[model samples]
Target: MITFCRKSFIKNVFNGQIRCKSANSVSLSYNKITGCVTTSNDSLPPVLIFHGLFGTKNNWKSISKAISSKTGRTVYSLDLRNHGSSPHTSGTDSTLIGMANDIELFLDDNHYKTATLIGHSLGGRTVLQFAYLWPERVEKLIAVDISPLPTIPQQFFTKTTFIDELSKSIENISNDLNMSSARKQVDDRLKPLITDAFIRGFFLMSLHKNEESEKLFWKFNLNSIKHMLENEYINKIEIKIPFNGPSLLVHGQQSDYVKKDDYNAIRELMPNVQIVSIPETGHYLHIEKPNHFIDCVISFMKLS
Candidate 1:
């Protein structure tokens, strides 16, 4: 098999954040999901990573690099619509089905018949829906801290996250800092409004530089995220047809996102499913135990 070193498909950075080759640059289209593809080896089926709620493709960049360098598989870290650098639309385009469709369109746009998928939280559930709706497109599944059973939106997230307040504070955001410490500086800027350090960090994930304004702004649309809370069904998945594909459910020991009883429903949808739990970790297990998370994914994908 031919093995290629790590690489990116991006043409340039839109200020500090990534800007994948747009429709004008490559055959890629913006209406189709936009993402950063790290590392490449044409011989193996690629591994795609999806971020959870309030997260973007940058959240998994290091992990994607590690997985690709170690496994020799192309890794695509995608920013699902309404989040990150992807186009934000309202109504139908904001649902899980919309995200699943974006993934489908992404594969077709890239000319890949099938690929391994790894998604966390909402991204995980979206991939599950994708598998149920388009089973043939998925070669393998790795869902972290999520299940097929629907999750109540209000219970997980809502306006309580202070997204509305933060959206209003975008104009006051500081100049772009092209360094790792930028998170802390931004965190300090938001610290006055959002007291909780953890919650502040979550909101900061969507923060990006506005190419025209030159001020740090959010890539995600506040309305779309808030809309999920309004429509309860947006969080709940209704996948009736069995996906019947090799799938993995990574449970977080400290998180209530995946309950004990959810396994039967998960197995019902993915009959050939394996459930693994990481100790001392919550919903964002990847951040807590990144190495363990990588190990679990690589082992299941048979890259180790």
Candidate 2:
């Protein structure tokens, strides 16, 4: 069973006073319901946000709050299973279908019969799978910075190497006695593998001192995520029926994740899809251009 944090606890997390913790024992079921940080109100058809791989609900806090206030609707930012404050399950539990089922449970647990789903990267794939499996439950769908292509072996290998190196760097940093030293050591090690400073900073956001362990560790389940990225996340989606809901696909113009060639396949699965591109940004378009991203979402959501 998933339990929400008290409002005070949620506030502490936002203020950087404490790391998020699970409020109750996590279920080991395949369709395990995950935790969430919500900006709720008595609004119909809430907007549900799902973060990318190696990301947490914390990453979307500001965005969620903004969207909630702007749209006059509740916004639920979720920590997909094995990441953030959610339960850490095996790689098999990290498959697209498994993640989609988690979303289904979340909606049911919260008494939400329908919602607008917004997801980024791996989360995007999850929402797409959810729309496919439970089309009637989705009011709308928005996918960010991802394509529906099968796993490319070379691309998979490249990402695997990066994640492996990153995990090793974090493990080494965890052994350092001094927090400052650990931070420096982690940055030094990551600088070589991740050239982009922004990307490096983004990854560091997952690093936090675990109160129980009394050591610095990644908030995400790195090993499980690595396995999922290698075996499940990159694989091609094989769904025959398309989700006929109002759908929007947002891409970062500078990112190759959603290229021109992938549009046909996207359109094939989402016949009524509207595509939007944010310029001068990469895969993390929302982070790089928040205003444009929000504008695109608002415009798409308002369309009749």
Candidate 2, residue 178: CA error in Å?
Answer: 4.4
Kindly report the root-mean-square deviation of model 1 from the true structure over all alpha carbons: 10.0
**RMSD to native for every prediction?**
10.0, 9.8
Clashes of each: 0, 1
Candidate 2 per-residue lDDT, tens place, 2-34, comes to 344433222113233333232322332221122
**Each prediction's TM-score against the native?**
0.78, 0.82
What lDDT does candidate 2 reach at residue 287? 93
Instruction: Note the residue pairs that clash in candidate 2.
Output: 150-236
Find the candidate with the highest TM-score and give its number.
2
Q: Indicate the residue-level lDDT of 71 in model 2.
A: 70
Where does candidate 2 stray beyond 4 Å? 1-43, 151-158, 172-178
Highest lDDT: give the candidate number.
2
Local accuracy of candidate 1 as per-residue lDDT tens digits, 1-304: 3332124332333235332332211121222122234434577777888887778888887898778877777778888777777777774346676677677667756778799999898788788878886687689999998887766434424553666666666554456556345556667767778787776777777766666766766777777777765574356665768888888899788888887777787687789998998999988889889999989988899832
- Which residue segments of model 1 deviate by more than 4 Å? 1-41, 153-156, 171-199, 209-211, 214-216
